[model samples]
Structures are given as C-alpha cells and as structure tokens.
Target: MNISTYRQLIPSPVALVTGANKGIGFEISRILAESGIFVWMAGRDSARIKEATASLKKAGLPVDAISLDVTDPQSVESAAQHVQTVSGALDILVNNAGIVNERRLNKAGEPEVIPPSQIELNTLRQTYETNVFGVFTVTKAFLSLLRKSPAGRIVNMSSGLGSLTQRSDPNWAYSVVNALAYCSSKTAVNGITVAFAKELKDTPIKVNAADPGYCATDLNGHSGPRTPTQGAEIAVRLATLPEDGPTCGYFDENGPVPW
Candidate 1:
C-alpha cells in the first residue's frame, strides 16, 4: 500500500521508538506505523537511522528518522524538543534501546560462558548505561509531551532473563544462560517501570515492561528461534492499550510475567 493508503487505517497516534534503526526496535516501529501511528524511529547512528527510515518510507510506512542516543542526555533532550515542536504531543514512548555483553556469546556459538565472578565491572556498567539508565533518560525527557495526550503509554523493552523467578527455576531453558550484566540491567528496568507507574497512578499515563521472548536479532547473533516481528507483539499490545489496561507490570506474549 502507498503512504496515503496506510494513513487511512487506525486513528493516528504519535509514537517514539528508541533503538529503532534495526532488530526488534525496527520491527516494532513498522508494526506501529502499519496500524496508522506516525512513528519516530530513533537511533544513535545517522547512517543506520537514515537507511532504516528510508526503507520504512519506501514500504509506505509512516516513519521519521530521529537522531536519539538514549545514553546521551543532550541527544535525548534534543529529540524530545524536536518532537514537541513538530508533533505537539507524544502518545506513546517505547524504550527499546539496550545492549548485551559480547564477551560471552555470539552467532559463532561460544564454548565458554562468562560467569558473574569473571565478568568485568566495566562491562556491567556499560550494559546498565544503555539498558537501565537509557530508559530513565528517555522517559524523563519526553514525559511532558506524553502528559499532554489523553492517554499516554510507556513501553519498556524488557526481557524474561531479568525475572528472578525464572532464574531461580532449575528446569527453565534460559536458567543456565545467565549473563550477570545483561540480566541485572533488565531487572533494574522492571524496577524503573513499576516505580514510574506508581508515581503516575492517578494519571492517564500507563507504564509497563514487555519481555520480547528471545527473538533472533543482532543482540543474540540471530540464534533465538523467534523472529523480531513475533517478539514485537506484546510491546505493540501495551503501546496501544485501552484506557482500562493494566500498568506497572511486566508482561510477555501470553500474559503477566513474574517480577
């Protein structure tokens, strides 16, 4: 369909998706745009952002390239300002930018796993900088614009690896795959999601975290069985949630995930 035809689907809702230059973030942006939402596809790289945006536009999706580095405060501020100037209000904010430790595993299939004791502090810090702290930075920057909407939604791209419940289970498939840095960073994101939800309880804004369920993306070297399009389902659900939808919770494709 052409861009004009795509525009006639759902009532337009403005959305900003961070780390959307590729992978699950890009898939989520495509889905949102397919549903008639105008999406700002935000990423740190100018070249990648341009390429991704051009691809989406060619596909007749409503998407704009946005230079957003979640780890950089000034960049986040600039993105928020530009959105406000152009879109006036933001109906949804999807915090999807994050990183995983490369030292342990990749597509080549690693032989040795890096244990918690062996993991470097710098690696952990870098993971948190993008996964945990980045969410806080982006959310804070666009909160005002979100508040302007009749019903605002914040979707934090989280993972089941963060669940202490799953990690403690002996039979779970991913139980043995724990990488301390990435796991702990996601746990922190869940905390941040709940905290913001509580603080905004009385308002129309809803904040929730989504577990993409092991998608085959660059983060995992395409080893995961599920595709990015499949992984984006839960996030898209939460992003366009009804007025009565639950908030301050972590969810997967099936239902609520244990914190």
Candidate 2:
C-alpha cells in the first residue's frame, strides 16, 4: 500500500517534525515512527523530505513527507492545513528547524567562528527568522489542531548554548565559542516555549524545550562529538511525555537545565 493508505490504517498518535530531512530531526522522526506514532517529516525541500520518509517506509514505519518552510508564514499555514485534512488532529509538534549564522570561511577557505562583535545585523535577523519567528508562526497555525487532540505536546529544539547560566560562567568549556545570533535565538526559543506552556498549562497540551547537546549536524559543520541519534533522545522523550510530565521546563538527557 501507499503512504496515504498506511497512514489511514494506523490509528496511532500523530507527530509533525520540521527540518526532519536529516540529522537530529530525521532521528526524532525515525524514533517516533518506530514507536508506532505516525510521523509527518516536514522540510522545505520536497525531494529531501521524500527521501527521508521513503527510508522509513522501506522499514515498515508509518511516515510521510510534507513540504514546510518554517520561515514562511504561508508555507507553515499550508502545512498545518494539510495535516488537519489528513490526520484531523495533531498529537505532537516538534519545532526542530533552525540555523546557525555565526560562522564564515577564513582566508584558507576553512570555517571560522564569527565573534559577537563582528556579526552583522542581517545575520542576527536571519537566525531569528527561522529559530524564533518560525516557531511562533508554526505553533500558532497548528495549535488549533493540537487542541483537538486528547493530549497534545509541543517540543521546541533548543541548545545548551542558549543557557545564560552556562554562558555566564567564565570556566565553561564552550565559553570561547560564542555565536551571538545562534545562541541568542535559542534563548528566545526557550522563552517562547515557557510562554506557550504557561498559556496552555490548564489544558491538556504540554510545551517544553529540549537541549539536544552539540551533535554532529550540518548546523555545526558536524564537529560535535555526539551523534544525531544521541542528541535526538531527549527530544523524543519530551515529545512523548506522559500526562503528568512537567511543562514549561528545559531539559537535556541528564535532567533539568537551569534557566
């Protein structure tokens, strides 16, 4: 049977993951699909998302691809409409689409970190466009459908770099790797997560942020020691949290991360 037929056959929970064509987003989609939740692997590139969903379908996982560009309001709305039309409601929404603009090529053509002072205003705007505004746009569009579910969950992909507490420490291991645009965007994501969680606390919906520690993804030139699958674990956990799970909180694999 085709993907649409497969989707109809499974009455399981549904999940939508943005930027799911590769890396940590792909892993989150894989894990969720493996666990019996029908997943919508969303991305801006149709070909990439198609390939991603096909890989899982080959393994008998319930998944399909959707064209979604988080930074575009029209694209986000269209994606939500498609999900509502196909699945009726959304059980989980993972805001995993983001970008890092704190790096540039050096004289030797090697990637070099751009310091906070040297970063341009356009770079910051571009980072926030996808990392912050995109989250708000997508969440607002799909929230009505999420509310339709008996239990809804929202997982915002944050980074440990976003932690002001860690950034404040002079002895922090990554203290030297400061990218103002990327780091501050994640901090804004954390703030957005808390705001949404607070607004929906009385309801069945739960919103939380996941700090998928530095993983070898395209966002960071694949320099991290951790693998994408390893980083995805925390997001999967937060996405599938129980009814009693904590909302409006930030967490990594180890435990709660200080605000």
Among all candidates shown, the one with the greatest TM-score = 2
Please provide the root mean square deviation of candidate 1 (C-alpha atoms, Å): 3.6
lDDT of 1: 0.90
Writing each residue's lDDT as its tens digit, candidate 1 over 237-259 gives 88888776899999999999998
Q: List ranges where model 1 is wrong by over 4 Å.
A: 1-10, 105-112
TM-score of each: 0.93, 0.94
Model 2 poorest ten-residue lDDT run: 1-10
Off-target runs (Cα >4 Å) in candidate 2 are: 1-11, 107-109
Every model: Cα RMSD to truth? 3.6, 4.4
- Each model's lDDT comes to 0.90, 0.90
Error of 1 at 223 (Å): 0.5
- Give the C-alpha miss distance for residue 118 in model 2, angstroms: 1.4
Model 2 RMSD in Å is 4.4
